[model samples]
Target chain A: MTTAAVTGIGVVAPNGLGVADYWSAVLRGQPAIGPIPDSTYPVRFAGQVVGFEPDRHLPGRLVPQTDRMTQFAIAAADWAVQDAKLDLSGFDPLDVGVVTAGTSGGFSFGQRELANLCHRGPEHVSAYMSFAWFYAVNSGQISIRHDLRGPTGVLVADQAGGLDALAQARRKVRQGTRLVLTGGLDCPLCPYSLTAQLAGGRLSDRDDPATAYLPFDVRAGGHVPGEGGAILVLEDRAQAGARGAAVYGEIAGYGATTDPHPDSGRPPNLRRAIELALADAGLHPADVAVVFADAAAVPELDQAEARALAEVFGPHGVPVTAPKTAIGRIYAGGGPLDVVAALLALRERVIPPTVNVARRTVDRAVDLVEAPRPLTGSAALVLARGVGGFNSALVVSTRDIVDR
Target chain B: MDAFTLAELIRIMRECAGEDDQVDLDGDVAEVDFAELGYDSLALLETAGRLAREWGVSLPEEELTQVRTPAGYVALVNRELAQSGAGG
Candidate 1:
């Protein structure tokens, strides 16, 4: 099987806009969730992307029509393309593909247009309405913007779609796509979006900003929603090497499954996803030294996930952390963000603390690093489970492989 | 009911639908698209769901789909609640 390598990565998260800034904030583990400056959202607190002005990254003509989520996708894609060190100026656009996942697309834009229609009329609505809120908006826009004509697609499988998008990108790369822009962007802070999330019954209604989004804590209630995007450049290892590009990590294996009705009370299908990913990577649970958990911040969700880990690796213990806890749940963007963190953690050989996991209520057989700790294993697994059934697990191995 | 009052309802609608003219209880909703009023499919579903929770009524997906305008949405919801005793 052809191995998929992650050559470049770009992130626009609440902590920081890029990888370096985001990583620094993650290590500090401070709560970035706070009052929404947007004024239109019902929920006061959110993990907003600071200092992000879409016009700076996206061209002026393109900015007026796209939604905030699409803007994030484009900006992150630009960063990933630059990081990949591949000049698309000469490559065939057909050899490039775009795949992405997002929970709410163009919600803010749709909200704006709706307000206008309510006040003025349909004539006031912009022509961009058709494209803005579509779930595939990001993928279509990114593909067109980057001139990537290769097999573009989008995933609607809840939050698990992000990882699935990367897996699809890996397949495209193996099938001869020179480069694949893969990731997700979602901004659901608008009152309309927040009201929608209310139905999910997973949002933290605590209202008290600081304690609202505590994952794996004894008082865990629910996760606070946030918005952002992350994109990675997936290319054939040989092709990347031939161009002397910097290789970050390889996309070794990806596994996914669904639980159908997990909300009321259903066991997490994590074992199947984790085991399948390990099998796909030709590795065992023991080979993985660190784990990046989904950490949804719900008491039951955290418990189930902890148990799943214990079932797979047992009490022997591996360093497990949920860095996304600090940034809040970015919905479809969460898994890919965790993937980015895992890749960096493996490279540095140190797992970042599972921010807010300082007081672990559940007796986790795995070493729950309240603080960042050294990652001993060369391989690591990134685990994520979405509301209403989607579970995904991805394996990342260090670039340097020896006689193992 | 306080939940469906023109002012309060409009306030909630403003968040999802975007900045629109003031809405009234007797306004024509079919003339408006939920997206144009700042609500997408998910947002509208969520709003309907929230109304269900607050009003103690379950607004079916079909009922919500009929909400094309602001006043129409209120009328449909109010009618459904009255018939189903959502205001208990």
Candidate 2:
């Protein structure tokens, strides 16, 4: 089987804009969740990507056409391409593709246009609103900007969409596409979207940022909404080797399962997704070095995830971490960002700590890495769950594992 | 009853779609094609929408699409303003 190697990574997380800044902040367990600036919504706190000047990253024309989400995607994609040192001129445009996950299409843009409709008239809306607010706009905009004419798509499974997008990109690369830009970036921290999120009854209503989103903690309530995510370059392992691109890791395997109806009496099948991902990677339960948890933060959800992990890996069998506790749940962006963290963890040979989580309050069945710890294994598993019962698990391994 | 001048059109164009560095909008660009000026159909639509809001003259979509140059767009807006009895 052709393995897809991650050659480059770009991140625009709330705590940090670029890969270096994000990684440093994650390692330090710095929390970026705070009061949503200038927001009138009842949901007061969220992880906003402050200091992002779209004019600095994108051409002026693109700034108006895109929502903040797409702007983050374009900027991150540009960085990923640059990091890979892959010249578009060197490959046929049709050979390169883009796949991304998006949750809310441009909420800020839609809110403005809807305000126009309510106040002035329909004529007051910007023409860009037609495509700007569509869920697939991120993938479309990235493909148009980079002229990636090959397979292009966007998955909309909420948080799990990011890993699914990456899994799709891996399939595309294995199917002989020269290269694929995959992952997700989402910015839903606007009044309209915040109202929608609040209606879901899943967001943490706590005013204090420090205790707002405590995943896996005994005091777990709910997650804080957040903006921004990551984009990565995935190329065929042989092609990446030929180009001498730095390999971060190999996208070894992916598995996704949907939960049964809540009233159906069947338990959530997250364990099946994890087991399937490990099996697809030809890995044993003991092979995974670390588990990047979904960390929904809601007590029941957290307990369910903990139960799944404990069932699969045995009681405190493997190291588990939820670095997202620092940045909040960024919807679709959460999964890809977790994947980036996993790859970085594998590279650095250390597990980043899950902040704001008390060890004594954590589930005794799962060994939550509340502090940075040395990693002695070669593989990592990333898990994500969407609101509507979407469960996805992906296994990424050191490139040496693929080589051997 | 204010006339839509070339200066006003240039301002609206820049406000709707950012200026292209390669195209000199500050020079004699009245008769230049909007395509050459780097303002595509969507940019022109946004500019038209702004004009309707600021000038209170609704330019028809068909008439707006027929405009190929900034001068033509200015004339179209002025004609709409006159027909609506809002222009001198």
- TM-score for each model: 0.79, 0.94
> Which candidate tops lDDT?
2
CA-only RMSD, every prediction: 12.4, 2.2
Q: After superposition, how far is residue A132 of candidate 2 from its true place, in Å?
A: 1.4
Q: i-RMS, every candidate?
A: 11.8, 1.4
**Residue pairs with clashing backbones, model 2:** none
TM-score of B chain for each model?
Answer: 0.66, 0.93
lDDT for residue A108 in candidate 1, whole number 0-100: 86
TM-score of chain A of 1: 0.95
**Per-candidate clash tally:** 15, 0
Mind giving the per-residue lDDT tens digits that candidate 2 earns over A52-150?
A: 898888777788778899999999999888888888778899999999998979998899889988998897788899899998998898898788899
